[model samples]
Target: MQNEKRDQLVVSKKTYKKSNELINAMGKGTALSQKLFAIGMQNIKVDETNNVVATIYGTELRKMFKSSSGSLYEHIEALCDRQIKGATIFDWNLLMKDKENGKIEAHQVVTDASFKNGTLTLRYNNSLTDKIVNLQKDYTVLSLADTLSLKSVYSLRLYEMLKSAYDYQRAVTKMQGEMVFEYKLTELKLELGIINSGGSKEIKTELEKEFPDYDRIDELAEKTGQTKYKEYKIFNRNVLSKAKEELNKKTSLQVDYEPIKNGRKTEGIRFFVTKKDAEAVEKTAEVAVNKDEILDDLIDLMHDDFKLREIRELAELAEYDYDKIKKSYDYMNSYSSPVDVPIAFMKDCIKNEYYNNKTTKFRPKSSNSFNNFEQRNDYDFEELEKKLLDN
Candidate 1:
């Protein structure tokens, strides 16, 4: 019974999508609060009319947070006080669409919360939901398993930041190049919630507007007692290094970074990220461990665009029929040219048995070649808007 119940709460295979804006939101919360918030976001369900709400049972919460001390209800109550701190301005102009640019912000994500009979109920702000729901573009997929597996708030946030940036590099920008992330040192610190409420006079003034009572840095620290990594060396060692090590070792991404210098001072960071191959996938999670050897073999044969989770599911569906699956994979890859979305095409080929007795070259209705693409050449509008709108 214990094993069965534990199985019911396993979230390692679940995934959620969030807009790039939400992924980069300057949100601050405790590690547990962030995990809870992520789980809440994952479970949010929208009806035909677009109404949505999330309910988290105390049983699952206790299971996930068994390591925490004190009452679980207390944590739920404290969740209401957490704030998301800044508005996000999405520049639709970059897409070259005719639509106007839009702005969305929410002071608090968990607008209301209540616990009764060992279950916690949460109502999210509409502004927060609007960005996530029905997102047509500029979004990133968040693995609930990956988020829950991470222990530190910094690691979780860094993972999301890098993941979103990597997605943008791949999808929207159509770069089709190696994953690279460069951020100003001050901006990086703020994104990770490390040096909150600091920087130039303009930045400080804007942050002050969010909390009128704490107008000055010292006053804010005195009242709320800020925990900040002010020293660059310490922040690099404790936050960035630790998160990088954890993300590389445990998650689907392998990351490495170095600080950029200006004369004598470190001014920015440049990160290199890549997707792990089959061998690395085999080493990380227990689910991969328990799968048959055929799954790893299939993963080795597949492309990078297909996620590890999706490949795992596909492997199970194929029922270890290596020959049949391999035929489908070969059919897709050996087509006249690459499919616009190879994964979707491969799924159909396998499900519909299109590989059976196939001899002719398969041609997609249309194909978008990702080869020889250049890096993003424009950052003017986005940088300006972020500087003006972000806290």
Candidate 2:
């Protein structure tokens, strides 16, 4: 029986679906650990014994993060120690079947984790198999690339929450309206692990006692503080703002929030989430380009610099007529002068049928010319005419 269970796809941009409950899992880990958890989900499959497991390799980790040889092993060791120490909490308050009650279940996600030969093998808890594996509906599909690109654990958690909420509204609700989510301030803080709201009063009391200065965000406490994000302003500045910035800069989602207030006190947060087209995540996850293919090849061969995302948007503009897109791309590339912004110029060329203007060669007077062009003294008219006639 084959024991290995990992994805065959070389690129991590592949998508994975998780139940909404699981997506909102309040378990916290380091940014890399959270990323590893996402990768585990992406590579999830049944092992020889029919148990769900994910196998990750050190070499793969190095490649994914582009880490050096010496530090990579140390990082892997640190990750293994964290998982073994139960630092990556999978504990979640899963909803009961009655739908009126919630149960605080503390379960180790990696029930059994072993590191051998620079590979880590993890066996998931039996109780979570249903939530993580057997999903029928109310699931959120996420890109592994997008999740991995997030640097902060808060950003990752918020991204998952917003993505899940947006997907559910669009697909399940089907209301054909704007997607918005409102969360109580305390609830949001709890979810982001900013504050501890444990199941037992004893645990909560213990946290409060240990971090007695948790809520002190005064000018003095701001300089030297034990706990974090006790005040709404501090929380907004530290967690919410950073998460929003990272999400907008790195992921496909655009998110903004307004504080729900009552009597000058913050009550809750209302979030507005929207998805971008064609350009989902960063190009950090570079899929090996196939030279024979037009979209991938163009992405690979283009002399102009573009984010993997911008290139994808350009391909989407092609509308399956890659030949025309290629012509525009060639026109942009063959121009004697340098283009200030190649993508914008190529987009205009594709949009306005500039690629097909065979009679006259268009040369721009300035670097930012998109609508108009002026002839240059060093214009290679002979070569341009030759190329046009050949076409």
Candidate 3:
């Protein structure tokens, strides 16, 4: 079975290489640009030329044309009118065929007048140049979905781990019921027993033997006004005995009692362990467990999980909208899987925000000449004035 699987993977790699070669061949010389132009025309037919540009130029162009920062389609239209002199137009049907066949993949569009020797070149589409102007609308949607799926999977995994951590802490608290004086004594005795057993010494005899050598013991007894060692022993025994008796009686009688008195009580215990040990537990428990050697793994994982690849893909399809992408990025960061409510909630929140919003300011189109480029406006002055007055 392993051998068969390996063989299948090898075959798949070969297929991919063959397909890539074919795609490359189809994109060379006149054939390349013509196919690209066809793809571009397809995009234009579906009113997605801006998306093509966004995929090509990305946020860099959006920043360059701030007025159309979130509207890649608008930027592309403007670029066609001003920079390209309306020479470039999308041929949608041809682009869709190329995309469906996997011969052409939409990456981004180049609205720069300097592209292809001063002709607006749709740079990264793998299809023929004639199809370059055509945009594949459905591909944009699918790309967004793919991006969302990857992000969702990562986010869900991280959220589950954090939830597990919270539950683990809760379980630990429940297991610890109550800590009475007797319990503390027992714990101390256990620790002492461990120390004594490891050295093959009887604890009481060893303490007595070491008593004369320890100046602190003598000083403590003196400060407490107990002169003789025998007297000090008796006093310690009586105090401990009374506390133990009270604790045992309370437990035996099934009486609920708080043993802590006059001091701040801790609800949990914190201790350090080797990184190897922590990771071992984390694997089984679904928590952010890692060897201390990689302290930053948690941060890196969370960052990767929340940043949806689909959002970027969608931006590519629509023409990169710097403002919209920035807003989406900010929203994603605000509700990270580790810190925010839950993974499910975070996914829903981002999806809702992304899908519902209609306008984004991120992609900007270049003007006819760099020297005479007009600054794009992003704000609706009338709407802003109304909102301000209402507030």
Candidate 4:
């Protein structure tokens, strides 16, 4: 779990989504710090002074860290101490570029947090709270179920980047299964917390001229093997591959990338994302299928020989009409368990068809069992590749 487990938002069932603007302004922090911040975002309140406030109960806070680094109670105390009494507060630096004035408008959103008797109440600096709150309408909802399984800060950061940019839903009718996004390598690195922020050549030159030379940091990074991601090859090997491996292994999304080329050089990354059926992975949401659809239409949806056979087997076992069989598959995806190993799981479902004959059923609990099955399949695929290469 990387030194800290993924910040599973267990404090409440309510999912909290924050504006990208707010998320961007929060500078570097540990995974634990981020987990605490996420908890505070659960519910926002407006006070008598028109100020924005968010409260988190100590019990809920403890729940967020229950399976993480240390004892939940101890972590709660330590986090509260740092948040309340620490001299250097991690303040928000909400900034906007004023190209017309050749200046940057920075509004610092200072947090005044208090903890007493298992409750945390946060009061935001009034100067920019309104602006930040206004952007909430355009917020990204972080998937709590997925984040709980995340291991490292890097993976969490990458998860946020992909969720915010690519995988987020933009329309109501679109399939939420896959997303493709292209990001500049430098921007991608920044999103992963690999390095500090960067801007255009002119802005970099202007800032460089204004500030003292800090180029020695690059040399130090080279000596330390950090390498700064200056070389394309190393960036792909050290950063992109590692993130892809972790996400594909642990999370619901399948992540991959195609290099964007500048004629003979790699300049950016085009990421291909495929999200697992959340209903399937969680085995919890119910979706109604059309009873009007004829058997032929349902058969068309399962347009492969094996899938057709699987459907036929279920049809025969459950003594269900084709329309009924179709509903079973749909309900299995939405209300039953995930189908990572579809063929095998389908066979198992066929054997136990009567159990699901009434309407819906819960497959055996596997604790993110879908991910476990995914990891096994990936391992098997890798072994097959090695054998093919040897051949």
Best by TM-score: 2
> What are the runs in model 3 whose C-alpha is more than 4 Å off?
1-181, 185-391
Candidate 1: pairs in clash: none
lDDT of 1 by residue, 277-310 (tens): 7566546755422342455466567634454456
Better of 2 and 3 by lDDT: 2
lDDT measured at residue 222 in model 4 versus the true structure, 0 to 100: 43
Candidate 4 regions exceeding 4 Å error are 1-13, 23-27, 48-51, 67-71, 80-110, 131-136, 167-169, 172-177, 197-229, 249-252, 283-391
- Model 2 accuracy (lDDT, Cα): 0.60
* Candidate 2 residue lDDT tens string, 1-391: 0111122134344777877776665444456555666667756787666568888887776545433224345445544554444343233233222223333445456666666788877777676677778688878888776776666779988988898888777876776435789987765765675544334444334333423232331222234331477678998998899989878866778889999998999978999888766544333222211111344455555623654446657777876457767788788777767777677777878877686775544543355464334333343333222211110
What do the candidate models score in CA lDDT, each in turn?
0.60, 0.60, 0.28, 0.51
Writing each residue's lDDT as its tens digit, candidate 3 over 1-391 gives 2443343233222210012122222111111122223223322322233333312233323221111223333434443443433223231111111433333222223333223322344433433333333333211111111111111111212122222333344455663322222222212222211111122223222233422222333334345443431232342354333433322221111112223222553221221111123343224222211111121222233333432233323334333434444444555465324322223333343445543443431222333454433244443333222211111
State in Å the error of residue 28, model 3.
70
The clash count for each model shown is: 0, 0, 62, 1
Per-residue lDDT of 42 in model 4:
68
Q: Per-candidate RMSD vs. true structure?
A: 20.7, 13.9, 30.4, 15.7
Answer with 1 or 3, whichever has the higher lDDT. 1
Q: CA shift at 150, candidate 3, in angstroms?
A: 30
Residue 64 local lDDT, model 3: 19
Error of 2 at 386 (Å): 54
> lDDT per residue, candidate 4, 236-347, as tens digits?
7877788787677555567888999989877679988877665544432111011112222444555442333344455456454564455546555664444554554444
* Cα shift from native, residue 315, model 4 (Å): 42
